[model samples]
Target: MKRFQRIAGYLVAAALVGYFLWFASSNLDIRVLHELLTPPVIGTLIVAALAYAAIIPVTGWAWARLLAAQGESWPVSWLTAVLAVTQLAKYLPGNIAQHAGRAGLAMREGMAGKSVAITVLQETVLAVAASLIVGVSMLAASEPGLAQLPDGVRPVLAWVVPILLLSVLFLSTVHLSPARLATSPTRAMRLLGKAGGLPGARIALPALAAYAFNYLLIGSGLWLLARSAELPAALDLPLITAAFALSWLLGFLAPGAPAGLGVREGILIVLLAGVGSDGELLAFVLLARATTMLGDVINFLLGSLWLSLTRRIAR
Candidate 1:
């Protein structure tokens, strides 16, 4: 069953990759692609890519600090490498692979697998909490017309209300607890561990800052890209970038869909739709995907080759 699932997952992942490749190729608006590839765009894309990579350190720091709470210290270099490499896994299919790879590396580094997994879980929970907080602010700042959304949407919002309340209440409770909780595998019990007298409130400020900076870096890069492409108005690009960030986050969370294969494209198309002609939007999306994927493919090849050589040398 596991083998079959893995095979099927690979098939789906492959199909998505192939689909994007062909879609980009066949629909290549040569003129638009050329314009999008200009110097300023090249620079913005480079900067955007760096920003995307930059967030890894903040995450590594978060993971390291959290693990320190459990009396474990691992090299930031090791953690940083694992974070960067495993990120490639996100573009494929399952997020579990990234977690699994990180866990294996952590285990190999002398930390318990469960402990490392717990740290990963803690980072995810806090990151998610941070995103939710942003979502609330976005909701508040937006026009209330969306509030008059369909009745069906109202129920979802209603559900969200209680969930948010519960989350905040739970966080308050955790905030009041003492620092230094046990490292356990149980999710329910672990919440208490996270909830304890830890400095989560203070930690949240930085985490929020990191998350915002992480996305803003990407957004600003895209803004530069848009400026190069001569796309109109910067007002909503940040929102589009927010949508892109949300999609990227979803890609990160997706099970086995490395970097969210169909996921990134899906998110990007939606975001780009309102701003440009279909021809222009499609061209931009294709170029953006190509730029990032090329770097990833190069890194993957380099890592694979290095691993193979190192093994041969030991023999």
Candidate 2:
């Protein structure tokens, strides 16, 4: 069953990637891409890549804090290294691979499997909540762009309430007290398993804040890419940021999209439709994808180096 699921996921991912390529080739002017290779634009892309890469350590920090909240003590450096190395797994067919990779690596490093599992669940929930918080707040503040979104897309907003409610329920229920668990032990166990525990407010709140900040960094990278494409000055940064955040959420939620590959770009193009010429918007989307890929590569390299150095020092 798992093997079949994996194959199906790969097929879906391949189709999405193919669609993205087709869209790029059909709508984007090749000349615009070449023109964007100017020294100044290249510099901006580099900066944008770096900005995207910075999210890795912050994510690692948040995860580490979660672990600490649960009475697990692991070095943040090691945790970050694990995240950086596994980061590429997000591009794999199933979005779950990255979390699995993290769990596997942490377990190999002597962390309990149950702790890793629960913390990962907590992290996923918190991350999604953070994305919604940023995306919705920004969208609300920038009503003009919200009004511009296609009518079909507007219904997605209705999902916000249910998703938030579910997230809140998961975070709260997972931390049921021992006495409460004992009363409905079977039901609670089914819901949380043996590994369920919630991080305290101090830990969760800060982690949520950090994840929100990471979204800003992600949006800033896209904004930089848009600027590199010489988009119109009238396009508000908040709108652009909100576009990316919402696109990211959509992508993240999508199944078998491989880091939200085609899905994110498609949504971004729709959201920022009037920001620039079609050619420029296409160029900006392609550049934004490239920027993030480059950032992931940078993070993987830096993380590898960190792990290597730490091992050497310990030896």
Candidate 3:
């Protein structure tokens, strides 16, 4: 049964990836592709890619803070590598493979398994919550009656409210008692299985700040890409930032939607309605995705190099 379930999951992931690739390719033309390959745009794309990669360190810092609360400390370089490499795993059938990879790496680096697990959970919750906080804040600040969310998106927003509340509750409660969390990964798991807790506080504020900054960095990248593409100057930076964050949040909430697949693109386009012609919008979305993939490659290479250097130093 377990094996069958695993196979099913892989099939679903492959299908989702296939669908998104088809959607993008169908909308792309040889001329459009060639146009994007121009030297100037390519340079801008590289810069945008680096901007996306920049979010990783902020992520590592947040995770590091969580681990530190458990009485374990791992180098930021190690955590970043673990995060960057494992990012590709989210494309696999099971969405949790990335989490498993991070847990394995953290344990290898001396963090208890349960500590790793708890931190991962907390990080996921906080990250989403931070995205929501940024998204909703921006939405509210916009001139009243500017635009209403799409009907389809309204349900997704509704569904996320309870999760956001629960995440806040978890964060507030977890730090109340951080003493003697656990000695070993196995012990940590056993303790969690019996009860349910793990730790953080002093760094908690900074961690959240880092997580929020990470979103802003991503949004900034989107803005850069928009500018490079000569997208509407009228769109404004804050609106673009909020739009991407909200679209991303919608994508993250979508189940079986590998990296938010069609869901994200759809939401983004809807949010940016009237910003440009349909052709231009499609081009921007494709460019954004291309730059994002480039960023992933950069992240993988940097993380691999850092990991190799650290290993050599240790040896």
**How should the candidates be ordered by lDDT, best one leading?**
2, 3, 1
Off by over 4 Å in 3: 1-29, 141-174, 178-201
- Best by the TM-score measure: 2
lDDT of each: 0.58, 0.76, 0.70
Q: Is candidate 2 or candidate 3 better by lDDT?
A: 2
For each candidate, give its TM-score against the true structure. 0.67, 0.83, 0.77
Best by lDDT: 2
| lDDT of each residue in 1-315, candidate 3, tens digit only | 977765675555455456556656666676866776777678888898898898898899888888777677887867888888777766665467777877887778778887787777777767776777777655545442134555575556455656664666466545534333444357755565433353444756677778778777877777777787676664556676777777777666554554555656766766766766666767777777777778878888888888888889989
Show where candidate 2 strays beyond 4 Å. Answer: 1-22, 147-182, 185-190, 193-195
- RMSD vs true structure, all candidates: 6.6, 4.0, 5.6
Residue 124 lDDT, candidate 1, scale 0-100: 73
Score candidate 1 by TM-score against the native: 0.67
Q: How many backbone clashes does candidate 2 have?
A: 0
> Could you tell me the TM-score of candidate 2?
0.83
